[model samples]
Target chain A: MTVLARARRVREALLGGRNQTWHATEALRRGLLLGVGLVVAGVLAHNVVLALLGAPLLAASVLALSTKPSGTPKVTVLPVARTGEAGETALATVRVDPGHGAELLAIRLPDKGNPGPGPVHLLPASVAEIACGLYRRAWGEGVDLRLDHLVAGPDALIVHGPMVGREVSRVLLPPVRELPAGPVPARPAGLVGVHRSRRPGDSTDLRTIRPFQPGDRMRRIDWRVSLRSNDSMPYVRENHAESDADVVLVLDTRFDVAAEIADWSLPARGAAVRPGGSLDTAVRAAASLAASYLRQGDRVGLVDLGRPRLYVRPGAGRRQLLRLRNQLVVCARSAGWSSRPVLNAHQVSGGALVVVLSPFLDDAVVGATVQAARRGNLVLAMDVLPAELVAEPEDRWGEPVRQIITLERRVRLDALRGHGIAVLPWSSAEQGLHVLRPGARRSR
Target chain B: MGRVRGRGVPGWRLRAAVGVVGALIVLVLAVQGVTAVLIGLVGFVAVAAVALPGSPAAMLLIGVSAVATAVLPGEPLRWEVLVLIPLVHLLHLSCALAAILPRGGRLHLAALRAPVRRFAFVQAGAFGLAGLVALLPSDRADPVVEVLGLLGAAGLVLLVAALLRDRDRVG
Candidate 1:
C-alpha cells in the first residue's frame, strides 16, 4: 500500500462513515414521500385544502432533514459498581455526545442475562445521561451491561446508529452466609492466635497454676495464689498457647445440578453455575466456611477439585477473605467435569481441616474425598445436593429416575461414612463445631 | 417486535401508544370512506409500525393517509382530513421513539421532554395551517385561491427556513 493509496483509503473511510452515520428512518421517508406527493397532487387537482394540510408534514420532515447530525455520537458505559454480590442490583450510567442535530437517543440497559442488547431506553438526545440498573441473578463473573445505542434526528426522521458500545463487565461475588462451624481446633504450630495450642503461651484461657522455678520473671508470680499456698515457691499462672489452624476448603465443580432432575443434563445456557444448583451451593458454602475460619484467626485456602490451577494458598487476614471470594468466582466461572478430582496431599497442610463441598453425584468425587481422608487430613464431606428433588412432569419414568438418584446418593453418603469421613449436609447448622471441643482433634 | 412486553423493558408502553395513534389514522380513513386498499394498508402499517418501527411500513402508512386525504369525495376542508396531519406525525414520532428503546431500564420523564416538545410544536403549527385553511374564502382549486395558497405556502417555507437558521445560530 503506497502512502497516496493509504491516504485515499483513509479519506474514503472517513467519508463513508460520515455518509453512513445518518440514514433516513421510516418516519423520514414517509414524511418526505407523502408531503411532496400530496402537495403536488392536491395543487394539480385544484384541491387547495389538501395542499394546506400537506404543508406541516412537509415542514416537519424538512426540519428533521435540515437538522442533519454533524458528528457521530460517542457512547460510553460507565459501570457504577465493578463488583457486586448475587441478588444485588448494579447500576451503570450511559453517556452519549451526539455533537449537534440529534433529537432523540436510544440506549439498551441491563436486563437479567437477556440475550442481545437487553432493553432499549429511548430518550431525547438532550438527556445525555441514562441510568441502567441490572439485577445480578446468580453468582460468578458476568457481563453486567452491553450498552447499545442509537441517536436520531428530530421527529425521528434520521438515525445515526445501532452502534454497539463495548460491554461493561462486573464480577458478581457469591453471597456469603454465616456458616456456624465448630470451634477452631487447637494447633501446636503458630506462635499467636485465638485457639489453644498444646504448648503454653500468652492467651487468657488458663492452662494451670504451677510453682515458679528459677529464671522465671517476677511478673509471672500470682501473689494471691502464692499467699494461699504454703510452699516456699512462688506460683505462676500458665496458659495454653494460642495458635492458628489452617483450613483448606475443597470445592467440587465437577458437575452442577439443581433440584430439577429433568434439567440436570441440560447445558447451562449462559450461566456459569445455575442459581441454587449444587455447584452454586458448594461455592457459597465454601465462602461461608472460609469466612468463619478466617474470623477465628485460622488460615483458610481454596482448592478447586476440577481445576487445580485455581488453588489459593492458605493465608489469614481480612484481605484473605476478599481473595477467597474473588477466587471463588473464577473457580465457578470454569466449573465443569474433569476426569479425576485433584485434592493432592500437598494442596492440604498437615492437620488442616479439609471440607469437601460436592453433591457426591459420582464415584470419582467420592473416591477423591476418601483419598483425602486416608492422607491423614481432618476431612468433612459437605453434601450440597438440593434435597427437594423435582421430577420431570412429562417424563413417564420421572419417579423411577428420582428414586434411583436418591437411593444412589444415599448409598454414597453411607460409603463415605464407612470410610470414616464425616458426611454432613450443607444445611446442617452445627457442622464442624465438634472440632473445637477439648481433645476433639482427630486425624485419618 | 410487539411481543416485547417484558416488565423491565423501557418504552414498554410506547408501543401501545403508537398502536393507538396508528389506529386513529386508520379509523379516520375508514370513516372518510376512502379506498379499502388504502385503509387496509394504513391498518397494516399501524400494526407493523409498532412491531417493527424501523421498517418502511410507517412511511407507507403516511403516504396512504396522504392519498386518502387527496381522493376522499367529501368537503375538501373536512375536519377529518385536517386531523390526519397531526395523527400521522404522532404515529411517526411514537414509532420512531419506540424503536429506540425496545426493551430495560426505567423511562425517565425528562427523556421524553425534547421529542414530545418537538411533536407538540409541529402539531401546533400543523393545526395552525388547518385554521388558516378554514378562514380562506372558498373553493381552493380556483386560480385566485391558488395564488394565495402559493403565497401562504411560500410564507410557510420561509418560516421553516427561519427556524432552521435559528437552530444553526443556536448551535
Candidate 2:
C-alpha cells in the first residue's frame, strides 16, 4: 500500500469508526475571562492603593492564554466479525487513544438478542488499571448479540470486549426453478418413502412393532397370523420416516418494527431481540429457523421477500446452512421494493411447504405468499407481530388510545387469517415458535 | 544549529553587564529622590567592583544596599562615611570572589571541596556582618530602619544561596 493508504488505515483503526468532530470554543472562553477582568479592573480603579491589583489581573490573563489545552482525543472502530453463534461471545476490539487527557464516560455494547441491564464504564486515567474477565448473559435460547456504541479516550489506549451469546447463522436457498405447465408426474427420486419396520402397504421397509394401541389403524393388521393363533391381543406398529416435503422459509425484510427507539412511549416489552432494527431481527429469526429445520434432516431453503431477490437453493449439509445464514446477515433490502416483482408460487414443485415469516405490513409480499399457497404448496405463514403492540407504554397515552391501536393490529392479523394463511403474532411472554398458531376457524 | 566551541558567553562580560545594570538602577533612584548622586554612584561602583570578582549577581545585592542607604534620612555627605562605604563593599566583594576563584595552595581533596563550602560560608558571613552593623546603636538612623536593613541583608543571603545552588548544579 501507498503511504496515504497506510495512513488512512491507521487513522481509521485509531478512531474506531467515522464520527463528528468538535473544536474548542476559545473565543467564548476568552470573552468570559475578559468580562471577569473588566469587573476586577473597575473595582480596583477606585483608589491608588488598589491600582496595583491590575498588574496581577494582567499577569493572570496572559498565563491563562499561554496554558491553553493543546489537542483533543478521538476514538475509531475497525474491522468487526460479521456473525456469531447463540450462547457464544463474539470478540470486537476497539482502539481508543487520545491526543490529550480525557475521561471515559460510558461504552454501550450491542444487545446480543438480550436487553443490556446497564452501560459499562472503564477505569479513569488516575487509576490506570484494566480488568480482564467480563461477560454478558445470554438473552434467549437463540439470539444474536449486536454491537451498538463504543466510547473511549482523552488518553490513547485500545480496549477489547466481547459481544457474548447471540445467534449468528447464514442460509442459502436454491434458485426457484419453474415447474412445467402441464400434468406433473412423480419423479422416482422425489417420492416420499415409508419406514421399513412396518407391514408393506405403501412402505418400503419394516418399522417397529408394538402391542395393540387404541389409535392403531385396522388396515395395517397381519390377518394371516391372527387367524393361525386365534389371537385375542392385537399388535400395533410404529413408523418413523422422513417426509419428502421441502420447506422454503420466506423472510420479509422490508420494514422491521423493532428498529424504533424504546422510551417512555415504548414500555418494558420483553427482551428486545432486534434493538438494532426490525430488519435485523427478521433476518436473524429466519436464519435461526432455517438452521433448526435443516438440522432435523429436512431439505430447507430461504427466500428474502424484499429487494435484490435473495434465493438460496434447497440443499442438505452444514455448509449450505452456513451459506444461507451469511447471505441473510449481509443482504440489504430497499424500503419500497416488492417481492411480487420476482416470485410466483405456481412455479414451485408439488408437496413443497412454503413457510413465509413476515410482519405482513406490505401488500405485495402478502399477495406473493397467498399465490404460493394457491399453487398446492403446503404454505405456513409465520406472522411477525409489530413490536409496537407490546412495546408501546400504556401510561404514555390514555388507555383508550392504546386499546384502539391494539384493536387495529388485531384487525390486520384477522385479515391475514381470512386469506387462509397461518399467522403467528410474536410475544415476549412465550416462545415465538409456539406462541401464535392458526386457530380452528382460520386453519382452512 | 551552529556549534560554538567554548562556553557561549565570556564570564567577565556577564559580570560587567550585571554590574552596570545594577549600578544604573541605584543611580536612577538616587537621582529621582534628589539624594547626593555622587554618594550613591560611588557606593554602587565600589560594590560592583568587589562583587564582580566573585559572581555577577552579587552586584545586585550591592546595588540594593545603595538604594536602601540612599532612601534613608541622614546627614547628606561625610568624607569618613564615603570611605567606609567603599571599604565595606570591597571586603564583601573580596570574600565572594574568593569563594568562586579558588586560591592555589594545597593539592588535597579538602582543598578541592573548599570553593563550594566557602561560597556558602561567605554568603552566611556577609549576612551576619550586615545584620550586626544594622543592629548597632547609631545616632545616624532609627531602630526600625535598622531592623528593616537587617531583614534586607537576610534576603540577600537567600539570593546568594539560590545562585550558588544553581552554579553548583550546572558545574
Candidate 3:
C-alpha cells in the first residue's frame, strides 16, 4: 500500500472513537418522586397547610414530559505522535464542540481496548477540548479511543466522519534506523596502497608464507626459498589495502550507560531513565554513520547489544537501509538491559571494522568493546554523553565524588586506547560522530 | 454508587399516593362544618379548574360554588369569604393555561409576557378580596343555605382530585 494509506490506517487504529456517557436518569426520577410524595403525605397528615400548593406539583409533571433534548455534540480526534520507540509517551488530542447552550454531562476515552477516563469541563457553547496520552509498551499497529460506553475504533472514524473535516487528524511516527551491512569503501583518489587479495592474484607485495597445496600458482612460488631449503615449496600470498576495511556498528542499549545528557552532576543520581531514554541518540548516530559508510561502498552490519539482540547480516542497497531503519525503531520500543550480556566472545569471530556507539557509562559495555577489539577487529568506540554532563556545575556535589568519577572515566578511556581501540566522545549538541583514530595523521 | 435506571417512583405508587392524599385532605375539610366546607369546596373547584380539559366546565363549577356560598347557613358570610372566590377561580385558570400551552418557542415567550403576568396578578388580587369578604358579617338562616354549603363541600372534594390528577399526568 502507499505510505499515506498506511499512515492513515495507523492513525485510525491509534486515535479512534472513545466518547460515551453514563447518565443516571432513573436516579433523578426516583429523587423527584420521593420529594413530591413526602410533601403530599405531610399535607394530608396536617403537618403543613397551604391555600393552593398542590397546583404547582401538577403543573411541573406536565412540563417535564413535554421537554426533549437536542442533537448530540460534535467531536474531533488528533493523534500527536505515531511510530514512537517502545516506552515513549504518544500524545493524542480529542476536541469536541457542543452546540449552543448544550451541556455535556460526561466523557470517556480508552486505549487499545483498555478504558482511560478523562476529565470533563464546560465548553463555551459549541466548543470543547480533551487531550490524551498513552505509553506504548509493545510494537504493533492500531490504537483506538472509547467514548461513553461505546467503542469508537479506527474503522468508525474512517466510516462515519467526513475525511476532510476539522473533526480528526491522524499522525504516523516513523521508526528509528540504525546500521546495516553493505559494500566495501572505494580507495581514495591519488592515494596508493597495496591491494588486498582474497585469493592469489597479480601483486608485487609478499603478504605471508605458508605450506602450499598442489593448486598453488607457479607464479607465487619463491625460487630463492626453494634453493635455501633444497626442496619443492610454495607460498600463499595476500596484500592489505586501506579500502578493504569492514565497519561493524555496535549500538549499546544497556541501562548503566546513560544515553542522555545528565541533569545532575552525577549520572546515577538522577531519576530512573524513562522508556525512550538516551537510546534514541545512539540509534540516530548509528544510522548516519551507516549511511556514510554505505555511500563509500564499505561492508556495514549492525549488532544491537541491548536486552533483545538484533543482528543485520552484511548487505547493500536502499532496501537494506530501510529494513535496518525499521528494525531500529522497533528495538527502541522493546530492548532494555538484562542480567546477561547481549554480546559474547563468539559473536565477533569474523574480523571486521567495529564501531561501538554507546555512552560507556556502564562497565559491562566498556568490557564488551575491549573484547571485540582484542579479537583483531578494527573497533571504533563512539561514546555518546548528554550535553548537560559537560556543563554541570562542580558545586552540585562533593569535589571528591566528581574527581573519582572523572578519574575512572579517564582510566577507562586510556585502557581502551592502550588496547588499540578508537574511542570518540560525543554529546547531543555535537554535529556528528567525533573520529578517534590512533595517530594525529590518521584522524577520522 | 449504585446505577440509576428507569423513571423516578414506580407509576402505580405515584398514582396511589396522590389519590390517597386527595381523599384524606377532602375528608378532613368536610368534618369542619359550613365554613370549612366552603373553603374545601373552593380548593376542590380550584384544582378541578386547572386539571379538567374544558374551561367552561370549570367556570360552571365556580358559579355553582359561588351561589351556594352566598345562600349557605351555619356561619354568616364574612368579607374574607367574598374575596376568596374570584381569587380561587383565577388560580385555577392560570393552572389550566400552564397545561394547554407548549413549553418552548413562542408559547414560552408568551407565558413570560406582561399580559400573562397581569392576568396572574388580577387573579391573586381577587382571591385576597374574597378573603377580606369572609371577615364581613351576613344574615342567612335557611336549610337551602345548609344544602348549598353541603354541595360546596362535595365540589371541594372533586376539585382536590382534579388538582392531584393534573399533577400526576404532567409529572
Candidate 4:
C-alpha cells in the first residue's frame, strides 16, 4: 500500500468506531499560545525571566506534538448480570487491545445507569482491562450503564474520543425482608410439601386409631392400640402427612401511587411509585412471601394482572425463585394504569391460595379481586395503598375528592370482606398472619 | 433524578484549589498598579474556567496573563516572578485537568506522575537557561534584529505545530 493509504488503514484500525480526529485539548492550546507568545515577547523586550517562564509551556507543546497516536483501540464491554438484589454490587469489565502510541484511556459510566460518570483510568499498554462497579440502590429494571471513552495521546494534549459508549441493562430485585408466611388455609393438593395434611400418613401430628389395612406397613401398627382393642380387627394409630400448597402471587400493576395524593394531577412521568409508595410496598411484600414459602419447599407462582403476558408458572427451587424475582422486576418496569385488571381463571389453579396485591384505586381492580374469590380460590387482598393520601395542590376541590375516594375504598374493602375474601392492608397482613396462627400470641 | 452521587472527589474542591492559587499569584503581583488589573482579570477568568474548563477562553487567558506579567515596563527582574511562573502554570494545568475529568472522578496521582515530572524538568531548564542568558555578554540589538528574532520564533512554532497535526484520516 502507498504511505497515505497505509496511514489511513492504520487510523481506521486504531479509532474503530470513534471519531478519528486528534483534536487539540485546552492544555495543548494553552501551552502553545502562552509558550510561544511569552518567548517571542521576551526576546523582543530583552527580558530573560519572561522567556524563562515560558519554557514549560514550550516543552509541553514540543512533547505533545512529537508524535500522533497511531491506531484506534477497540473496547469490548462485557455483559453484566440481568438481575441483582437491592444493596447488592455487581461488577462489569471492558477490554481493549492497545492502539499504537495510545497512552491515557478514560471511561465514563453514564449518569443514567446507576449513578456518576464512573471512573477515569490510565491504562498501561499491556494492561487493557478496565473494571466497573455497579451498585443497585432501589428495585426496578433500569439501564445498567452506558460507556463513554476518551483516549489521550502520550502528553494528553491530543484526544481521540468522548464517543458514546454501549448501553446495557440491569434489573434489580426488590429486597426480601424476613416475614412470617402467615397461616395459609390448608389446601393440600400436592402429595409432598411443608403444610400438614389431615389425612393419615407419616407425620408428627397424631390422629385417632383406625383399623390396619393390607397395604399398611407393620411398623405403623400401634401395638398398644391393637392390644387394647382385644378384637380380631387390629387398630393402628394414624398421623397427618406433611403436604405442600400452591401459592399464587397476583400482582396488580394497574397503578403506581405516589404518597402525595395531589401528584395525581401532575404529569405521570414523575408519578412513579416512590420508595414507600404502594407498588414498592407490594413488590417487597411479594418478594418476601415468595422467598419465605419457596424456602419452606412450597410451590410458588407469580401472576401480573396488568400484563398477563408475564405470568410465571408454579415452581419450587432456587432457580425458580430467581426467575420469579426477575419476572417481578419486568412487571414493575411495564407497570401502569390499565383500563381493566385481568385475572383469568386459568392463571390460578383450583384450591390455590391467591394473594392479590393492589392499591384498589380503580373499580376494575376491586371487581377483579372479588371475582378471584368467587372462583373458589381462597383470596387474600393486600391493600397496597398508602395509609395517608395528600391532596393535589392544583385541584380546588381536593378535600372532597379525597374523602369520596376514601369512602369508596372502604366500601369496596368491606364488600370484599363480605364476599369471604380476606381484605387487609399490606402493613397488617404479616401481623394478621401472626394473629391467625393457632396459639400464637399477637405482638402489638 | 439525573444527579450523580458517590463521587470520589468533589468537583468544587478542585475548582477552589485552582481559584486560590490564581488569586494568590494575582495578589502578590498587585504592587504592579495598572498591570495588576490585567492579572486580576486573568485570575477571575481562571476561576470561571473551573465551571467551563475545556473552553479555549482559558488558553487565551493563560497567554494574556503571561504576557502581561512579562511586559510590565519599569519593574526590575524580581525573583517572585519566578515563583509566579509555576503557580500560573499549575493553575492552567489544574483547570484543564479538572475540566476533562469525568464527573465524580478522583485524581489518579500515579497517572499524573509523568506529566508533572516533565513540567518540573522544563521549569528547571527554563531557570537554568535564563541564568545562562543573563551571564552572556550584553549586545545592544537594533530594531531589525529584534523583529527578526520574534519572527523566527513564531515561524518555528507554526512549522512544528503544522508538522504535528495528523495528516492521515482519523478513524
TM-score of the second chain for every model: 0.72, 0.29, 0.36, 0.72
lDDT of 3 by residue, A109-194 (tens): 33332322321211112224445566454333334344431111110100012112332212223333343322222222112322
Docking verdict class for candidate 2 = incorrect
Model 4 steric clash pairs: A14-A71, A14-A72, A15-A72, A20-B170, A20-B171, A193-A243, A193-A244, A261-A390, A262-A392
Candidate 2 lDDT, tens digit per residue, A329-411?
53432333554434555335565667676666556666687778677665666666545544345457555654665566566
- Chain A TM-score of model 4 comes to 0.80
Q: What lDDT, from 0 to 1, does candidate 4 have?
A: 0.70
- Say which candidate scores most in DockQ: 4
Model 4 chain A: worst 10 consecutive residues (lDDT sum): A435-444
The most accurate candidate by TM-score is 1
- For model 3, what is the error of residue B130's alpha carbon versus the real structure, in angstroms, after optimal superposition? 20
Superposition error at B94 for model 1 (Å): 2.6
Model 1 lDDT per residue over A1-444, tens place: 999667755764766543346665556656665566567656666675566656666777776666667676787766467887878776666666766877666667666656434766666577565565677777787777776777777777667767776777778777778765443433534677776687877788788999998877788789999998887668998877778888889999888999999999898776777878898889888888888888878899999999999999999998999899999989888888575789888998877778889999888889988888787777778899997899998999998999998999999999999998777787663544554333255420
Instruction: List model 1 lDDT by residue over B56-133, tens digit each.
Output: 777777776776677667776678876777787777677766666654344545556666776678778877777776
Error of 3 at A392 (Å): 11
TM-score for each predicted model, relative to the true structure = 0.82, 0.38, 0.43, 0.80
**Model 4 C-alpha lDDT per residue in residues A314-423, reported as the tens digit of each score:** 99989888888888888887787455788999998987878899888877887887888788777888898888877776778987888888999898888888998777
Candidate 2 chain A minimal-lDDT segment of 10 residues: A180-189
lDDT of 4 at A367: 84
